[model samples]
Target: MSEAYDLFVIGGGINGAGIARDAAGRGMKVLLVEKDDLASHTSSASTKLVHGGLRYLEQFEFRLVGESLREREVLLANAPHIIWPLRFVLPHVKGMRPKWMLQLGLAIYDRLGGKKTLPGSHRLDLRKAPHQAILQDSLKSGFEYADCWVEDSRLVVLTAMDAEARGATVLTRTECTALERHADSWTATLEGDGGKRTIEAACVVNAAGPWVDTVARTALGSGTPAHLRLVKGSHIIVPRAYPGDHAYIFQQPDKRIVFAIPYERDFTLIGTTDMLYEGDLDRVEISAEERAYLREAVTRYFRSGVTEEDIVSTYAGVRPLYEDKAASNSTVTRDYVFEVEAEGGAPILSVYGGKITTYRKLAEHALEKLAGHIDVPGEGWTADAPLPGGDMKDGDFAHFLWEASERHPWIPPEMLLRLARAYGTRLDIVVGEASSLEGLGEYLGGDLYEAELTYLATHEYARSAEDVLWRRSKLALHLPQDAILAVGAWFDARREAATP
Candidate 1:
């Protein structure tokens, strides 16, 4: 008989990774499997905000809003490098929701969340310099509120890294092919580049995001698994539409809201159409209609019009919202629902419809549900714990950056800042004893160097250039085509040389 694990988790997105980290911290034996790179899908494709869904207040989802808002503070503490404060400017327009209504909504929004270190909502003068320069002349006033920007994909990777460090086994590019449940435990077959293997676990977490229902049915027989409503949300990246760090929230004629956010220091990110999705899940892309919709949506509020020629990149992902049969796709609950099957055998907890902001709470709640079925050795302690690189002195990232500059005088300021954001306190491991850029390694592309690539491969489970360029970081957007190809070639040559 093989050694049994206390928990077996499927998927490597935020929820799965969060669960793995939580379970491992509890001293439970855990094995987490991902079919592809971490955050390769919906988790990475988010609007990248650690925020309470302000619009949810209109849907009477006060509980969800409060929970998400509380988690934002928790996440900011856990991963300060990848998550930081972002202010949003919502301009008040005529023939729309009245200013009183907006004020009421913002007031409720400000209070629903717990004690906030972030600044509260206040009125904005759109006719002022930066706001006036960006907005249409007709727009006179607006409201400014606080949310946060996050490197969404990096959050997943860091969670997985923390899980592994805490004594859990994290297997990326590994698929849970088969699951056999017994009265006391579950036997799962996993396949990957490592071939095939089987493992036993007392409990199972089906956190496969979009494939949640499919995993449930596959594991528990075809007996009417939980229904999932996959809504497709797409975003377009254009040259920076505004000069300020603040983002914009535009209310559409159809009552839907679209956000135009500053992205990558050089681009504006406009997104998210909430259309009912019924297409290929793996190959989701911004459709011509969605692009036109987003372009028109932003152009309506901006003094400068956006055209197709300005689009630099585009991406789309399917959100696995728990089906509620709402009047419209946008009305569907962003809240998560769990279905635990433990009546006749080992428990299998299937997670459905969770957002990035509330993943930590969701994981804590999942463990609470499993408490009756298994021996939980650890308590819920993730709320205040810092992720791998987040434990800077006094949790102040700015101070940490200044200290890093003093320590590594030979490194370029831009490169140091980028590394500081990506690795946080762990930048020490990447820099090592190198006193200069030449000692660090050959420059691959952008700020990517051989030393950084080695660190990613050895520590972060990065296998290919795509994992480094896209998921691990957004270097793909900054690096030229030839530079990207060189990175790919470098990885290929190294792998070929190591092959027998």
Candidate 2:
């Protein structure tokens, strides 16, 4: 391994992974270390939407909204297969803000971004349209708007994959134990599956998400007043509750809004409560009360009610929102803040807060901020460059899917389309020279096949069956417990066979 690098990123979430990719692409030797598997933390536990935050307008956070709206378009363009358009139907309520105000917000949302391909926002009468069939009678009028949906965790992995492809060293399951400032550089102690090792870098970036302040204060011995607020957001997943393609935004009595979105191929995702989190990151779990709150919130809006029994899975994530000292967690600023600690000869750059929607721009701006401390001579190239498997023509996902279908005639249409969506042009590597379903090998669970599993294990840095089943693919959701156990056994046998 090299003794020193141009950059060292301390997390594997969206921000760190993105910065690593951008820097590596710019000819900077970079190293990214994540304590756990990539995106195992809050990056995977998001609402998984690229939105302009229509609600932010009410908080007068026009700057954040405008930036997010612009970012939404960029992200949608770069990863058209995984990041696609979503329409949200906001039903007007009796006691909430005026319709004209929502319309104004929609107008601002449309124009704030330099939109080229995705359709802009428009008004809709819920009672007069087919969407009415999905809603109750009280929702008479509403407006339909555009946003993008993303597979949040996969996006992080893809970013890391792209960084590695561009010659960045990615080390997961590596804990940053300590940092020592040497002359003109920083040496970091990292211990992972391969055991303890020391790596040196010109600059150290602390993008540890929830552990940002810990790295700054505890690890690096810098006490400059914590710049982050860890607010806990929880989400629940259930089998598809409603039969509509469009998502719903319901206004609650407390001025908070709840979203009921379509998820996966056969499930509905409802969530997210903004509550202040004052506990350990490892201990952040959805309380029974919080589950009731989410279920009740959804139950109030739609005719259907989701009880505890309906939730197939629950996840909680702590957003390291830039500390705003706001009373309501919902009112906390979603903007990011950076602190550069340059003392003597070394610099430690720390990233505080960011959203999945703005991660790309966040990375570009982050590098721009850290450029002054470290003498670097490269321009940012992330905005224009496509991510791995994402160099589609005109970013036309539909055309690409049709082409993939034509090439792989034996694969089911839905299966082919899904592969094209997830892997983009890289689907060729996953499907290989298969001419029939039998060529794909055994169906372990979900839509997973032995061919895809082998590809993931060999190419995508998948270490275990959980890495393949849970994170790489949501086969755990579709597979029975016994099946998962069998897959785990198979992975163990395969790994052992390869071991020296």
Candidate 3:
């Protein structure tokens, strides 16, 4: 007999994971399946910010900005380890939007989200020490506001882990090949390492992100109306551009903004060009034009210009934005829209156009929509709930780190910080009973050890080196090439040993 579930969620991105976690918490038997790894596509490819779209105010997306701003507070409180405050310096230029407009926008942004832990926006003197040395001479002043930096893929994994902990089944590297809708349930064909099988679910949530239309067509047939405007956003990473913990928000002539954030402790992450994407969804990469565009975009502001020679790595992902008929790709609404189709048979809620900051709220809204067609039992509860390893005293990550340092003084400060930030209160699980560095199992490279990999595979559903290096953690950026190869070999050995 096929396994039965109250909810079946497709897509392992933030929205799908959040939906599964929310639904499972609401007393529903849930199963979430992802064709690839969690956050392997668009979710992992974000600019990695949790903020109210400060620029969206110009497009009058007040509701989205407000909701995102509010979510910043909720998410920060819930997951302080991965989601914390980041200050942004928005430099003002003579030809750009006037200072008064910027000031007014910041004012509205500050008030729209209501009372919050993060500080409100304020003016800055760019002629000061850090800005004078970092920015061009013509830039006399700017505005400073607060957002947050998130480990994008880690957030997805931790959310899925929480869902699993709450009794939901999370299957990674597993694809939902087909969906057969019945009046009271859905029979989905799933294919993965274990081969093919079918499972029945009372409802389905299509949070497939870039593949939303594909999944919808598979479930509702190919004639279904296409409502996705695929916009590709790309980012470039280079050796640290400037010296500071604060990030810069650069305004472009096209009225869009680009961010230059300090990444992985030793690199500057800049990016995100919005272009209409029409290529294969599975193989998205940054283009030559985008590389030059990003270089020029940052060069116009920084004292040190970014050139092609300085680029080290690049990534791109497509945002499956709801087709709002907006002329400019940059102006499409970041707010989520839902398409609930239940008239034919069982309910299938298709999600469209949402930002990472607002994913939790999107899930609540998704389940609320599903409730109209299915038996959604529990009330909204994710807002106050802490995700896996997120429970800290007063959600104070700093104090928690200090305490961890005391507990594991033998560990190096840098490695301790990385582990604590990645695992939070669950760092002990990664370390296991290792009382010293030697006990951490084989040293893979850098600060990585076999113990951490074991925890990831055992608890976090990590299957391959890419899953560990790129998504679950950014160790790939810091590890040597040989170490990277060794990680792959380790996974290969593990799989071989398990095989009959």
Candidate 4:
């Protein structure tokens, strides 16, 4: 194919995928390339809460918090399956902020963005309420509030799928090595399974997340490297340690807080140690000290208690925070920043910092910056567009699931739940006319079957077993190690057989 496109996007994270979805809907031809799989970087590694960043209230970021909170309701309406209501219990410590002040923050949160659906926050008496069941004995009071939980990595994949359906080319495992701006357009070089190819475009978007500065300096040769502050955030997964479905957020003496969230079916996600990082993004790792920090924080608040032995898995991500070094890691900004460089040719837009919760709005705002250079139809369209499988009645998945069960009466409950969450109204595509568990194809492991794998392979562009187990679904958390290896082997052989 000859070099041609209106826009060329580098990176496959949520920002890149969201931008591709937005621009394509406006009738622009887009090609998004990523060196690895989608959501392979910071996009997948998150605390997994779609809150308004209540802690940000102390940082005087009301505008950002409010805008994000508004999008929260919109996202819930858009993707109800993977994103749903979650309650959080913030155990009140004597030395922490006064009860009235904490209530003020929640009250503002509960009222911000014309609140609806979500329940308001309430003060708790640890001596009498069930919220105190998981609290350490020293704590006597607490508060309960609402936020939404998300399948972070799947959100990126769904956005890319939506973009592809809207006429954008989403390329995973494709690397953009260099670019040169001509008189009116830019030529970019990419290397991948499609072999070396050249693409021409009116503009380039560097939504490389952690690789933003590198793309600016190396590919587009912008000369001046944009400022970037990399902060390493790590999470640990442990067996469920408490009863009930609500999550817990505990305050530390340093004013930093930690979360213990119900994850998968029988696990709790405890994490996120934020420490200034100077390491290479490709080699981000959870330090032993960081693990100790997370475990210590969990132990301090949860009456069930957790130690290093309790941890089953750990993941670390490098936050591509915009360079504004603060006195502490907690003070660094989570809001996103964009820089556009036209340079007498095609404009190149670079995204610096952002979080999972604010991705959709960030995508809308980034496209707004490319007005004259990169052609867009008008305003925005993604706020109403359904993301991949998110199209359902009233954007409600529960109702869809109930109706699907009647259609496939013999299908197991496990298969039905997976289908509903991953494909929403399109569950039929995976289940088809299967009369029972056997008809769904071979069972790879817990909640994973050959039918779902084949559908992901043919439609969602899943190239490896990890794409299914880790990103597309969290089945890896339930499957045995041997079963995971078996599935990996199966996919590898299939890929080799289909090699061109």
Q: Whole-model lDDT for model 4 versus the true structure? A: 0.85
User: What lDDT score is found at residue 20 in candidate 3?
Assistant: 95
lDDT of each: 0.91, 0.84, 0.93, 0.85
Off by over 4 Å in 3: 223-226
Q: Supply the global lDDT for candidate 3.
A: 0.93
Which digits, one per residue and each the tens of the lDDT, describe model 2 over residues 1-500? Answer: 73789899999999999999988988999999999888888898888899888888888888888899888878888888789988888888777878888889888777775654568777788777566666777878888887888888788989999999999999988998988887678888888978898988999888999988888875456554656778889988999988868788878777878888998778888878888788989768988878998899887767668888999988898998888788788888888888888767688888888889888888888888888888765887887778777899999999988888888888888778767877898999998888888888987765668888788777777777777776776767778887798788878888789888
lDDT per residue as tens, model 3, 89-190 = 999999999999999999999999788888888999999989999999999999999999999999999999999989999998899999998888899999
Report the number of the highest-TM-score candidate: 3
Query: For every model shown, what is its TM-score relative to the native structure?
Result: 0.98, 0.96, 0.99, 0.97
Superior candidate under lDDT, 3 versus 4: 3
Error of 4 at 470 (Å): 0.9
lDDT tens digits, residue span 1-500, model 4: 66699889999998999899999988989999999999988988889888899998988788888887888888888988888899998877886798888889888888777867788899777765465566767888778888899988889988998899889998999999888888678788899987998889888899998888888887555433558888889999999878778888988888888899988878999878888888878878899999999889988877767888889988899888887767788878889999888876778899988888888899889888888665677778878877777778897777888898888877778768877887887788887677778888887777677888888888887888888888888888889988798789879988889988
Name the better of 2 and 4 by TM-score. Answer: 4
Q: Which has the better lDDT: candidate 1, or candidate 4?
A: 1
Instruction: Give the per-residue lDDT of model 1 (tens digit) for 1-500.
Output: 66589999999999999999999999999999999999999999999999999989889999999999999998998889889999999999999988998999999989987698899999988898888888889899989999999999999999999999999999999999899989999999988987998899999999999888778878888632567899999999998887888899999888889999999888899988998888877888889999999999988999898999999999899999998889889989999999899978899999999999999999999999899888887689899889978998777999999999999998889999999999999999999889989887988877778999889988998889999998899888899998899889888987898888
Off by over 4 Å in 1: 1-3, 223-225
Instruction: Note the residue pairs that clash in candidate 2.
Output: none
**Model 1 local distance difference test score:** 0.91
Positional deviation of residue 216's Cα in model 2 after best superposition, in angstroms: 1.1
* Model 2 global lDDT (CA atoms, 0 to 1): 0.84
